[model samples]
Target: MARASTHPRSCGLKHRGFGRRFALLLMPLLVVGCAWGSSSETRTGDRAVPDPDASENVTFYPTYGYLEDDEWVVPVRYWVWEDRGLVSRVVTRVASSMAGLEPQQVETFRHRLRPFSGDSEWRQRVTFVFEDDPLGQEYQVLDERGRAPRTDRNGVVEGKVRIPAQRAEELLAAQGSQGGWLRWEAVSRDHSGTGQAILVPSEGTSVISDIDDTIRITEIPAGWSVAVRNTFFDEFREAPGMPELYQEWDGEGDVLFHYVSGTPWQMYESLSEFLFHEETGYPEGTMHFRTVRKNLVSISTWRDLRSLVSAGAETADRKYEVIAGMMEDFPDRTFRLVGDTGEGDPEIYRSLARRFPGQVEEIVIRDITDDRTLRPERLEGMTVIPAETIERATGPDAIVADLRWQPQSVRVLW
Candidate 1:
């Protein structure tokens, strides 16, 4: 993924249209605002142990590493924040329900400002992002191998360490390929954190899958309110047979996974936990989530949230850029594109298939919309599997091109 703006307070979008549509929706909730400020930081602390008394905490983002020249470049990203408790007991009540209206283009916009999302889980999630003060803290890797990196204005630290390819291979080999964490010591706080790292080799089979309706059911087709309720209020429900199916592919031990989603980074912890849960059984792949910066303490934060609903924020471009970057980075590796018909996955994947032929081996689109008459041209070089019947596949892996599942002039009946 491309690096975000270097400036800390740089709110990326300044579109006027962002606020007009969602003005009434979040106006009442925006009536109440909070204040937050970061204190001067200090780096004096013991590196060996974590202190429960430490005021600041570090949250590591799970990511992947790549091989460049003779070294392995692994990204060490983290969020530094003070764990303030819930900001307020104020419930996020919907101003009005969107029962029949067509859902907006982006899921994040539709996922915002829910009325029934007053539960502790939803509140805590919001508080973590909006309430906490993200300090521009500094830290060094525990091994003292690379330069110590500091968190940006958003309290996020994006840095990398370069290890000799041979040594990196040794560590990865011992850590079980994707089963590894990098230890770090805080220079300013009396605490430490571990960042999960998945190492994708120079060339291999990688599965690029979508989240939302593709894996986790977000009910995008049910309209705006339901999608938001499902996101903020209800427990995430996994798509039928996907977790089991992904687990089967992950068991192969040679495949790499990349979960590309339009969901905001705020839902990362909850979504990641669900994916790694004992029942879910999905492979821990590199995550590609869109970032939407928000500060609940200000009325202006609503404008940032509104970007999710704005026309400019349609995720087709974001998904394309992310997936295309991956294909470019690993030119020799083959990729399998997986998504749902709930949105624009078919068209996006079709574009990728055309742009990078042979590199993308298969395109499997889960049919969330029950369109009996399929347009073969739209889904050219793809398999349209009904979302429900995808589980009936007692055979073939996710990328295994089955002749029976090939797309026809009408549709592929799985």
Candidate 2:
């Protein structure tokens, strides 16, 4: 205007190219100014944006791993119930999200915790559910109400609802004769036997095994020295060439593999699945896990039985129940009870063989101790195998005592 601002740097506002460069230089300043004004205005009167941290109330939420976007997590519960006279612990992983945690998480946790749970005695109900209204809201209210109670960071809520042992057992066994929540049903092992089963012509021979050290190697929690020994060493291992010997026996005779473990029925699937998966060395159809009952009656007295009965003989009741069930399924089967001298297997099997004389023809036990003072009085009529001899006999090419040892030649089918 005053001679058109004579300096070359003083570009006219009307000049489009010069104006474009000028606007570009001012763009950052403009954006900052707008943002500043918008923030001030928002603080003064406009609606505030949501605070993600404030809205998230996850302090009381149970510790869990991540989940993907838009993915639905299912809730599952592992119910422990009394099946027949024996307590059958089955996992019924439900698909609802109202229980407590997700089923996948529950299963993962179970898998992780199982190896360490070899000696746990407490039977507490574990529930899996989702984050929801009502129950989840109740958790929120409790958290809010008890915020000032000063928790121990370990999340032990003080004065929690503690159910007495008797009452808890009652609740767990309230359904029917086979009490409690019924959900999981494993396909009958016989029905699910492999399409290609290795079959030998009928010989009527059956194999019985000890539970604790013979098959499972559950490092029993004894004293620290014993615990260390059990932990570092497995008495439950399949002794050297036992599996191959059993396989060859299965190939030759109409043999059945029976595992007579001292492990409780609560460990049925844990032991069964482990043997089936990890110890595939054993013959397919010949597998069993001894189920036991532990009832705490008085201060220093507990009725422990392998077979389940209505009253008394808890362990025997469980064993007899399973053995009876097997008899019902497979009649004319002759069993040879194999056990170790260590725990109650020898005594228990002796009682069983005496009870069912026709069914149990032989009783073989591994002599677990060298102490001459502890040598058991050999039972009449039943064959007791020395531990060393049995170890040698389990090798693949070892000659069987006799083929005619089996009473009858039964039709061997898968």
Best by lDDT: 1
lDDT of 1: 0.54
- Poorest 10 consecutive residues of model 1 by lDDT? 121-130
Residues 238-263, candidate 1: write the lDDT tens digits.
88778877888777777888899877
- Residue 407, model 2, lDDT: 17
Instruction: For residue 145, give model 2's deviation from the true position in Å.
Output: 49
Candidate lDDT (C-alpha), each: 0.54, 0.33
Off by over 4 Å in 1: 1-54, 86-88, 91-149, 173-188, 295-303, 310-314, 372-376, 388-414
**Each model's TM-score, in the order given?**
0.67, 0.38
Residue 161, model 1, lDDT: 60
Steric clash pairs (candidate 1) = 8-153, 42-188, 43-187, 43-188, 93-115, 94-115
